[model samples]
Every structure is written in structure tokens, then in C-alpha cells.
Target: MHFSIPETEVRSDENGSTYVAYNIHVNGVLHCRVRYSQLLGLHEQILSDLYTFFVYEVRKVTKLFYFLPVVRQDPILGSSEMFNSFLRKAQQETQQIPTEEVQLEIYLFSGQKVKVNILTSDQTEDVLEAVASKLDLPDELVGYFSLFLVQERGDGGCTYVRKLQEFELPYVSITSLHSPNYRIVLRKSYWDTAYDSDVMDDRVGLNLLYAQTVSDIERGWILVNKEQHRQLKSLQEKGSKKEFIRLAQTLKYYGYIKFDPCITDFPEKGCHVIVGAGNNELNFHVKLPSDQMKEGSFKVTRMRCWRVTSSVPVANGTANPSSSSKCDVKLELAFEYLMSKDRLQWVTITSPQAIMMSICLQSMVDELMVKKSGGSIKKKKRLNGSFQRSDSQQAVKSPPLLVGAEVFTKLSSVSLRGLSSSNSASDISGNDFHGNYAFEGIGDDDL
Candidate 1:
């Protein structure tokens, strides 16, 4: 419930009208942004209520019956008709108020969904438990699964937007995006591939994993040859969920999260690349200008540090440009990679989803840290009794949201920054960069 307005920016709409946008962060993570007009109108509504309350108190104390014959005029309402209309439209879209209960359709990696009723005040953990209870997922195994906001692409692939934080309200987070392409998807959360066996031991978990693996194959996320594909098909036909998953795990990009084709400065500049993150590494398939493809991977253990930066375009001396004026604001992500004992290399990638990629990398590092520290796996307490498995059902489909394409059209340019040891070694060694554990226990041969 804690909130903070950490940053504010003056932004302009397509009509050239300027407005101050306040970025609202809840529990340290960016939640939503609101315009000045919207906040002003909301403030007016609160003031109106206070005015009514004070008037009633005064009338009671004074017993002002003598003023009853006088015509009383109500306070004038605020002139934010646009804000008022926005509130009304939001209510209509959600079909419920803050206090009312809403049904959230939580999707599994298998593309099946389970409907759970919750209030707007419910947190991510609450919804996860509700979905788990419906699926009859064991409490012990629950820790292995988490909810993610994934964008289903038009081509059947999915881009993971983020793992919903425990403090985040899933319904509000998803709805606030104002895009139908996003959904709350349940997926395995651990980074170590060794944990897959633990999940496969459970019937419900086995089926969920099986369904997701098959879906990945069908969507071409997992690469396989003719012989491997034929073998997998035979196991799948035999209803061998365990064997299927075990085999699929050996394939390329099995547990990796694949991103849409983006531009990266790896191997060559302006190379069209497809990136996947998993197993504590980033696998890249770059297509050169000559139509040749090159493959490369970057291990998290070799990274010294990484960051995501956003820059706005400014024209001449003006920080904000006119609506018709076009300027590029680059959204870039860069990471420092260890090449040798004393040598380092910086890799940069430009994409609208750079933020998500950064998050995935950080998550991988965190998972490894926990594993290396031998920390106990965090699990939620379970409810008594097991429930029946829900039938596999197709999720409600909608047109994919072209968020990246829209961003490119709105922004002027995009580029990433690189760091050299001679220029940034001190800064990297300081608190600014925390990935110093690159050489701790993992060696070059291990990577």
C-alpha cells in the first residue's frame, strides 16, 4: 500500500498540449504514471467532500434554521471534464469499482486459464495461491512457480514483460497497460535446471510442464532436428509427459525466454538478432547483412555489471520539442562482460523491451546467488486437501499489441552506451556496479 512519486516529467500529447506526468512507484518498482490534470481533478473531488462535511458540522452547531429560507448554492465542480470522462471509462472497462470483486483469468504456460475471483486490493501472492488452489498444486511445489505478465505475440510467441512482484496487484498491473495482449501467465520460476526433476515428480506439475514444452515446440521456440522431433512426437503420442519434458530439456533454448528479433551491436553493428535468456546465460542468433547467421552466448557469471538507460530527444536548446517535431529517445541496455583475467568487453543491445531483458538477466544472477549460497528454497504454506485437476481450455485471444512498433514511431532514435575498463574500472569497482562476484567461484572454464 506504500506509494511514492519518484520521478516526474513534462510530456506532450499528439495535439502538442503539454502536461506534467508523475511516475508512481509502489514499493520501489514503477507502477503507473498519472498526468497533472488527472491528479488535480482527483484532488478537487476530495475537497468537495470535505466542504460538504464541514458545512453539515457548522449547520448542526449553529442550528441555522433561519437560513433555511435562503437559496443555497452548491460548490462549483472542477473543470477537468477529460479527467472525469477517463474515470468513467476506466470503470466501464473494468466493470467494477475498487471495492468490488473481479474475476482474473490466470493463464498457464500451456495456454490454459483458471478464473479466480479477487478484489483490486489483492496482491500478486494472493492471486497465485488462489490459482494454485484451483489447480491443486502442492504447497511445497508452489514455490517453483510464479506469475509473469507475458505479451502473446501475433505469431504465437510470447515476450515476458516481467515477473510480478509480491507487492504488485496483478489485476491493476495488467489492466493499467491498456493493452489486451498482456496476461498473467503461470510458469516455472527457478533458474537451475536441476529443479525440473523435483517438479516432474508431481502429477499436476508434470502435466503443466509437459503442456508448456509441447506448446514451445509448436511455436518454434525450442529448436529440434528431424530425428529429435520424430522421437519427441512418439513420446508425446504415448502420453509420456515426463520423458517428453526430459527430452525437450536437452534441446536448444528449452527453458529460455525468447525475445522478438531486435538490433544488437554484437559480432557486428546493426546486426538483426534473436535473443534468448535462460540457464544463467544469454544466447544470441545474429543475422548479418550478408544473410549469414552467427551464434553466440554470454554467461551471467562472466558479467561484471549491466544497466538499462532511457534518453529523451532534445532539439537545439529546448528539452521538449513540438508535437510535429521528431526526436529520438534511445532505450538501450549494456552489460560488461569479462573476456580475460584482466580484460573486459562491453556488449550493448537496442530494443523497446530492453528493460525486460535487463530484468531477466538480474533475475538469473539472483537465482545463481541463492543457489551458490545454499539458501533454502522459499515456499508458501499450503492449504489442506487436494482439488481435482482443471480441464485444459484455450485462453481468450486478442490481437497482439504492437507496443515496440508504436514506441519506435513516437521516439526519435535509439542507441546503447559501452564502457571501457580504463574509463570505468573505478566506477565499476565502486558501489555503482555490484556484479563483482564475476570471478568469485565461477571460472572461465565453467562459463
Candidate 2:
């Protein structure tokens, strides 16, 4: 059983009429044909839903299909198909690696210590093989981080640690999700990898081979605790005492859950915000200039949404019903968004909710921006106290800012064939592999 799908091309006409066409051959039979007009994003969702059906059908037969999707030609992979494909591929069984791509955030502490956060659409294997191949770090412990721990169809589906401590002092410690700040903080001094790659091109903080980071999401380092995690119990249906208590601790310890007012330094035109987790499935807030936000007068007030996830209705008190005054600026959130690389595109809503979502995403953004040369230069003179490094790695350079879709395009374009492919089960193990794999999903069609 094999699934071979032709690369699709979707484009809109001057009239804004979008057309999409693709062909799929399953088991050498042209079984499905997909055609749609406009709404490429929605079309990807429908295609992903189709994948679930196909996966079930394939499993019943031989379970040896490629589910081949031509690399590059499909915009659906990024605009919408990404999440859906990830869910389906995680359950796939075959020698071929699924098209799902994993995104990660690596935090570099001064000295030798480091922390990495892995974010992937597919939750299959858990080693930082692809990452390690790019970096010069020793392969002792490859950590995994997630809000939810998945039992590998085995191990009761509980989460565990995979760490490597071969390096000298100030080396990395692995912990998943929110490991309640358990490790000892030797000193407040810290050195961060540049948020923008161009910042220090000459300085390879961690000499990387496959360290092809698509983008830097933010700045500040993450806080994780290991001892508290080791003591917790695993309870409920697929539950872990260590992980949950750790999450609660992270929220309280950081006072991150506490409310903060919305503030920013940029114009409200190209600006937007998200609330909750970094995933795009969350809510959104769009800030308009006093002139564009015509829902009456634009007042400088936070707006809350009717729903926790969606901004369906606008809560009152954010703006005047007249188009006279404009809303004041909350530019701070925009700077914060540099941390998480804006993988998720939140939905739009009213006052406080808009403010809340903006508050969260911006923090991530700001963190990353500070790492870039341009960002670092702006703050170099002002940064003070323990959080600052001696002669920060901001001497490199900075690239121009691009839209979210463009960033994805750049990432997908990088050849993954550089990473070793999966090996036979005989050699199957954690964090070890030997093969060449080219990541195919979007951006580059020549592959």
C-alpha cells in the first residue's frame, strides 16, 4: 500500500478566485482527485482530514505506503496542512520519515550550559538527532519538552528525561515542559545565542552542522526544575505527577499567569497579538491606527474576547462607537513576540483579549529580536544587571523582517537531506541514527 500525491499549485486570479488541483495515486490506482476554488487554507484542512481516512484505509491493507507528497509545490503544507499532516504522520508506520517538520527553540546560557525546547507537528521519535547533527554539542542527553507527555504506545505513555553531561561546567541540563526551577543557579551571569543568526555570523556559539534554525522565537532563558520532577507521581488517565506539579510551579514561580497591562512601542498597523500557548490555534487581536480602527473612536483600552480561544465578539469599553479618537499604543508586546517565532496565527478580537494575546506572543518575539544584531544594538547601551552578557554576540548582522508565511517558506526551503535518515529496527534506539534525509513539505520545489 502506497500513497503518492502529486504536488499541487494553488493561485488566485485577479478577481480573487483561487483554484487548486492535485492528483493522488494509492496502490498504483489514481484513487483521489482534489479540486477547489479559493480559500487555500480551508482546502488544506479538508486535505488533512482526507489523510486520516487514507491512513485508516492503508493500515487495513499492508501499512507500507509512502503517502508521498511532492516536496515544494504545495502552499497548503504551510498555510493549513501543517498541523493536520503532523497528527496523521505521528501514527504512520514505515521506513520513510513523515513529512511533518519539527521546530525547536534553543536557549544558550553563558559558560557551557544550554536548554532546548522542541515543537513539532509530529510526535514520533524524540531524539535531537537532526539538531545535534547541526551543532557541536556532545550527544549525552537529548531532552524533550511538551505541555503533554505522550506514552509511546508503551512505557504507559509517561514522559522521561534523556540527558547528556559529557561537557564541562556550565553545560546543558535536559527537562521537559515546565520542570519547576529545580537546578542550582550558580550565578546570575548569562550569555545568550543571538536571536537573529546574522547578529554574530562569525561567532558560532555552539558549532552546529545541522543546526539549521529556521528562526529564533524569542530571548530570555527558560526555567526548569529536575528534582521536583523526579519526586512527583504518575496519576489519572495517562497522567504524570512530576509534569503537572511542574507546570503549576512554573506558572506560580514565574508569576507568568499574573495579569500585565498591554503596552508596545510600534504603530498598530502591521501589529497583531495572541493569547495563551504559542500554537496558532489560539485567539488573536488586530490593532488598527486611530484612522483604520473605525468602530467609532479608538480609545487606549484593552479588549477581551467572548471566547477563550476565539475573538468572536468584542467586549465593551475598548472603543467609542464614534470614529473620532484613535487607540493609544501598546508597542511592548510586539517586541516580546520575538521569542516564539510566531508559528501560530491567532484569531482577532476586542480589547483586553487582544491585549492579552498580544502580551503573550510579543514576549517571545522580543526575546528573539534582542538576540539579533539590530535588536541587540538598540538595547546594548541600556541592558543592565545580571541578565546581560559581557560583550554580547550582536556584532554579526540582522536580516529584514518578513511575514509569517515567508518565514515558513524560508524554513521549508532548507534541505533536510543533510540529516541522516532513520535506520533499521535492529539499530533502532534513542538519539542515534545514520542516513541522509531531505525534508520535503514546502518552499523548494526543485527537490
**TM-score of every model versus the real structure:** 0.67, 0.20
Which stretches of model 1 miss by more than 4 angstroms? Answer: 1-21, 25-30, 33-97, 317-329, 380-447
Query: Model 1: per-residue lDDT, tens digit, 1-447?
Result: 112343466777779998766554332334555665665555455456536543443244221211111101111221123322333333333333365699999987676899999877566777888888999989888878889888878976777767876535688777767788988889887767788888898899898788878887888889999999999999978988898988998998898888888998866689898888887778788888888877767767666666554444554643432233333445567777764456576778887667678767756654654555555345643333212111111111111111245323323222221222321121233112222225334443443
Query: For candidate 2, lDDT tens digit of each residue in 1-447?
Result: 112332344545569997653433322223333443222443354455546433343233221112222221122222123433332332231112334444443332222433333433222122233333344423321221111111122322211111111110111121222343323211101112222222222223222201211011011112334553333222213344233423433421221221212322222334332222221112222244453321111100111111111111122633221122222221112211111122111222333323233333323223333333234322122132111222433222122122244222212111000111121112212322111111111111211
What TM-score does prediction 1 earn? 0.67
Q: Compare the candidates by TM-score and give the number of the best one.
A: 1
Question: lDDT scores for all predictions?
Answer: 0.60, 0.25
Residue 289 accuracy (lDDT) in model 1: 84
At residue 53, candidate 1 shows an lDDT of 41
In terms of lDDT, model 1 sits at 0.60
Q: What's the residue-level lDDT of 292 in candidate 2?
A: 33
Candidate 2 off by > 4 Å: 1-83, 86-129, 133-140, 145-307, 313-447
